[model samples]
Every structure is written in C-alpha cells, then in structure tokens.
Target: MNSAVFYSSKTDMWATPQDFFDALDAEFHFTLDACAVKENAKCEAYYTPEQDGLDQPWTGRVWCNPPYGRNVGQWVKKAHDTASGGGFVVMLLPARTDTRWFHDYIYGKTEVRFIKGRLKFGSCQNAAPFPSMVVIFGGEHKNE
Candidate 1:
C-alpha cells in the first residue's frame, strides 16, 4: 500500500470487497449503489460523485459505502432519513461509536454488525487502519 495514498485527504474512496458484497447482495438483492464510481459500482443504477447521492431519492435496497471523511456524518444522516421514509439502506462504515452521527442516527434506529477485523478495501494488500461495521436500516420498525 502506498503511504501517500492511504494518508491523502482527497482519497476517501474504498472499494468494497467483492466476496463480501456478493454475500450481502445475495441477501439484500441490492437494486442501487448510493455511492460509487463507474469502476466500482455494484449495481446498474448508481450515483456518482457528480450526481451527489445525498440529493437523490433512494429507493428499494441500497448499498452505500460513502466517502470516509469529515462529511461522513451527512451520509449517515441521509441513510437514516431515507430509511425512515421506507427505503432500505445498508451502509459500510468505520466503527466510530463515539461520533455524534453514530449516536444520533444509528444507536437504537438500526441493526448493526460489527466486523471482527479491519477490512482490506479495494486492491490494497493491507487492512484498513480502523475497524468496520455493517449498519442496516429500514428492514423493520425500530425505536428511533
């Protein structure tokens, strides 16, 4: 892994591992990727950076591996809002439980699966610096 690429502020994109995505796809049958570039998009219907997924109306089962940055809170918020409106969204996010977004939007509102270990995102040979979690929203009613 290139240290520069790992540390760069502009490089927030982390492609989801195919096998992991496949397993989720088998269960969720995701119909859209809420955030993706052309090369890494898991579904035919996807929102690119230029499209600003946050502004789009999410429908059906959605896969969201949003940019991991200061703005990640916004993505989490969007997911929660979409789910509240009857959309299903599965998010891949860093397990930062201390964050306000985690408490505000996720705590009692969704089903969370904490990954046991760091993920080796994209083609990187090394695991991510932080642990990851799969947060599922809108499959069933939960106290907000």
Candidate 2:
C-alpha cells in the first residue's frame, strides 16, 4: 500500500518532524505545546486532546499544530485570542489560504511563512499532499 493510503487509513495525527521543530525552537524558544500527545510533544509542557488545549491557558511562547480536521477553526481562534491577551503563539497549519479560518484569524493578525514545498511529516517517507505554513501571532510584527 502507498504512504498516502497508509496514513489516511491509520491516523490524521501528523507528527511534526523533530528537525523542523528544532529549527523553529532556535528562534521562538517555545515554552508550551498547545496541542500534543505525550509521544509527539515537542515541549516539556503540553496539552493533550483530553486536556482540551483550546481551554488551557496559553502563556509565554506557545507552539501549536492543531488537528487538521473540522475543528481547526476553534484552535485558530483560540490562538488569535491568546495572542491578543499578550501571549506569543506559533502555529503550523496547512496552507489553505482559501479557508474561512485563514481569512478571519490569520490574514491581518499574523506573520505568515509559506513553506516552499510539502513536508514529510513524522516517519512518512512521502511528502504531505498539501502544502504547509507557519504563522506567528503576538510577536514583534515582522510581516506588518
């Protein structure tokens, strides 16, 4: 079976590559992972699904790679609100610029970095079908 089919049948949770996380960590010094399971957490402090990351206090520099399913809007909204409250949040999101959440929360409020190519998430040998982006909120406005 192909990687895409394998992944699709198995899980929607795409673990972020450690090297990618390390590169971002060098700059952001992320203190909390707003969304993560124990096995995939990039930070010492993290919120698992059961913890409902959206309801948690997002203090300091937070790294969020929310689930790519239907509820992504909530996560994006939470990130925006947290940033407005003075916390910094960095998010890894699918580059779906056409989505409502993108226009509503990310367009004017954050600095966006569109990744050059699809990423090989986790241990998958094939690259992600969709492109990805990194968005920063509540930091010094580099895009503005």
Candidate 3:
C-alpha cells in the first residue's frame, strides 16, 4: 500500500465500519447522522455535505464521523456546544491526542474510548493508518 494514499488522500471522508457503528447505535439509539453523504449515511435523518452539519442544529443522539480534515476542530467545538446545551453527540475520530482540538475540546470535556486495534473502515482493503477513538459528549455514558 502506498503510504501517500493514507496520508494525503484527495478527500477526507472515511466511511465508518458498519459493525462499529451498529454497536454504538445500539447503545446511543442515534437520531441523526451529523455528517454523511447519501450513500454512507448511517441514520435515516442524516445531513449531507450540502447541508453543512457545522451550521445545523443537533438536537438528539447525534452520530458524527466528520471528514478528518482541517475543519475537524470546528466539528468538535460544535459537539461541545451542543452537549453544553443538553444534546448528545458521539464522534468517531482519529486518536490524534497531540492536536490542539484534542487538548482544547476533548481532553477533559468528553468520554474518549480508544480502539484497541486499527479499524478497517468501510470497503477499504487495508486498516486505517491511524488509531481511532470514540468521543462522547453527553448521554447516559457521558464523562460527567
């Protein structure tokens, strides 16, 4: 596998593994897919890229597997804001513990579950290059 494909792909979208999503859905009963395209949406009430989830209202058990790009900080901030307002949000994100977003938004504010092994995301033939973690913001299982 070319390391470049994993490091610098043209798009940042990485479809979440179905099994992983199912497990979380069973626990959270997610009401919306906060970030998805039509094809890979995990929930019936999903916001496509056109809807720009960053600008939308998240009012329930929301699942966010956002594009792991430059704007990921925005997504985390939104989740934090929504949770502060009593919404439940669960985010599947890279275990980038060193980043500014990790320290600023997730360090002490959310429940983070680091996966033991790399996940084979969607139909991709190889496992993801980076480790993953699930960050929960408000819910029965919230950090607080």
Summarize candidate 3's per-residue lDDT along 27-116 as a digit string, tens digits: 788989999877788999999889999999997789999999899999999999899898889999999999999999899988999999
In terms of lDDT, the poorest run of 10 residues in model 1 is 1-10
Clashes of each: 0, 0, 0
For each candidate, what is the lDDT? Answer: 0.88, 0.86, 0.87
lDDT of 2 at 95: 94
Per-model TM-score versus the true fold: 0.90, 0.90, 0.90
Q: What are the per-residue Cα lDDT tens digits for candidate 1 across 55-100? A: 9999878999999988999999999999888888999999999999
Count of clashes in candidate 3: 0
Q: Candidates 1 and 2: which is better by lDDT?
A: 1
Provide the lowest-lDDT 10-residue window in model 2. Answer: 1-10
User: What TM-score does model 2 achieve against the real structure?
Assistant: 0.90
For candidate 3, give the lDDT: 0.87
Reference-based lDDT, residue 4, model 3: 34
